[model samples]
Target: GFQFQMGDGGAFEMMGGGPRRKKPKFPKGVPKDIAKSMNWLKGTEWNWNSWRNVKFDKDGTFDAPTHDCQGGFCRWSASPEGKVYILWGDAGLHELQVQGAMPKEQDQAKMQGLRMKGRRTSDGERCQATFQRVFDFEAAELERDLYGILGLPDDAEEADIKKVYRKLSIKYHPDKNP
Candidate 1:
């Protein structure tokens, strides 16, 4: 029998082992800063753009889907100019997505306003890295309120929704009203 002792005062006995390895010990107490950070991380959200996007309340908590999305809470935005990023935040921003006609793939790269960052941090370094865009909606801010704002039901049909949208658009047109 081979007996090994770990740095944290734990010992383990092994049978027929070539090299002795120490058993890992659990920390007696978590650091206060680390504990606080972990608590905040628990509130962090990673949204997956399935077909139905996530909705948030006034307090920034999850609500419900805005509309009956087809594919899932789908992610269609991108940065070809290599500007958009997935950053680690010390204090995050209120991110939101706007629905519009998607630009051509080349034009998407020039859409520089789509940049995203983790919450602001004064003490940390700004580390940048490039990643192939997959389903990285962790920082996505989706707008799930268009249907609600229009006073339409969540299951409103496309034709009905479009008609309402046009009516509202014309009513709110600055050039026409002014």
Candidate 2:
């Protein structure tokens, strides 16, 4: 017969010597930052709602949610005790454990700069120049293709490029050409 215990210790024993603890499983759509914080909060009182309130205020304060809320979550601020906190429902408060500052890598910085420049430049000539500069910057990053060296489209796939290279190689072979 199966045994069933009945006290606090019994509950642990019934569930194989401890509380029935399963790993926390966040939804697929949860952002990495929120997920990170939530994972850290597992076993504590905090839950998904706590993750939702987290924000990374660039200026050390919370940004308005109505604005361009990048990273798919409202920004947050750090309390005097150095813990991350968010204001909820106009008056409610929630403490969040953010992993790090808002992600502002080099690429993000470039895009931010470009957006600021775009906002400032209203003249058609300036806009055209800006677009051209952006195009040149992006194009410079691409590897020059071997086909492009032979005046073929860079989009030519490996097989096509190889085929063209073989044809050219055979045509230029000295024994066959002379």
Candidate 3:
């Protein structure tokens, strides 16, 4: 029998001991600058479209599905376009699905299920990649809060913001001001 040994900083070689716990995932496509600064894995880097989506709190931690806690084959978003990812089991992150040039209709047929479910890195961590879109919510800058998140120009009139906010709010908001 070959006994496993921990050699030289343990840089993630799969020759360990006892059943080989799957390795955690590293994010991809995130700019090195941003990654180094935030310490998060780019949500857009993984393929979670076919995999069920996962959600996270503003703090970058994984939340329960529909807020549920029983983790499984669930992922965060769809394709490379969406953000956030939570995979079930100890999958090699690289094995996870991705947005390739293949046609949408034929995707399921290509499933070998040989994938990696890279666990999500929190939204704010040093040497990590973050989804800027989510961070925008917590942003405090007036210009960013108003224009960047709200989708308005800084020069837009108050009336415009209110009107748009009111209309958009009705659909998503909890109030019945209408």
Candidate 4:
């Protein structure tokens, strides 16, 4: 049997005359820095023009809720050169070329303020998307009381929000509730 390993510890074993590759050990999900840079994409609701609202997890999973694809089964990965790839199961794969001024030594505050524009190519069709990091206080106020519903403080961290959401989801799931 022959075995091969990547620099990142991804291993391939020879089994039955074929190579069976093991999952990569590092960077299972989007890198923290990349996820943080894309946080502005949160809270966007689905529209006719877009497929769904994007949700990213630190564990490399994502959810874009829609009639077509639901739950956190989707996954995303990025390369060192700033290319983001999304494996949206059934919905198809999407490749995004993220363009922004991301400095290596900047603080989170500066990173949060970074706006980006990207060209997305999916299923042979191309489209352009722009991301703005600005917050609209008035619009947020007008939006439903998500914090209240989630039983979290307005200033809760993203991780806290996701934790609470998962807890509530399991608690109120139709199968469990019913």
Candidate whose lDDT is highest: 4
Candidates 1 and 2 compared by TM-score, better number: 1
RMSD of each: 16.8, 18.4, 15.3, 16.5
Comparing 3 with 4 on TM-score, the higher-scoring candidate is 4
lDDT of each: 0.33, 0.34, 0.35, 0.50
The sequence of per-residue lDDT tens digits that candidate 3 reaches over residues 1-178 is 9989776665456545546333233357431122111222322122233434433332233333342234333233224332224432333221222222322221223423323333334432212221222222232122123464578887998998898888788878766653
- What TM-score does candidate 1 get on C-alpha atoms? 0.24
Residue 145 in model 2: shift from native, Å? 4.9
Residue-wise C-alpha lDDT for candidate 2, range 109-144, written one tens digit per residue: 333212101111122221101101121222222323
Evaluated against the true structure, the overall lDDT of model 4 is 0.50
List TM-score per model, in order: 0.24, 0.19, 0.22, 0.39
Ranking 2 against 3 by lDDT, winner: 3
lDDT of 2 at 146: 48
Q: After superposition, how far is residue 77 of candidate 1 from its true place, in Å?
A: 29
**Model 2: pairs clashing at backbone N, Cα or C within 3 Å:** 55-75, 55-76, 56-75, 56-76
Query: Tens digit of lDDT per residue, candidate 1, span 1-178?
Result: 9999765643433434556433222222311121211111111222323333232222223322443222222111123321222211222222222223322321223433322232223344343222113232332223234577699998999999999989989999999998
Candidate 1 lDDT at 85 equals 20
> Model 4 reaches what TM-score against the true structure?
0.39
User: Given candidate 1, what's the lDDT at residue 37?
Assistant: 11
lDDT tens digits, residue span 1-178, model 4: 9998756633443234575333332233444233434433333221212443354444455556653344555666555565656666655556666557643432335544343333334446664334323233232224345797789999999999999989988998999988
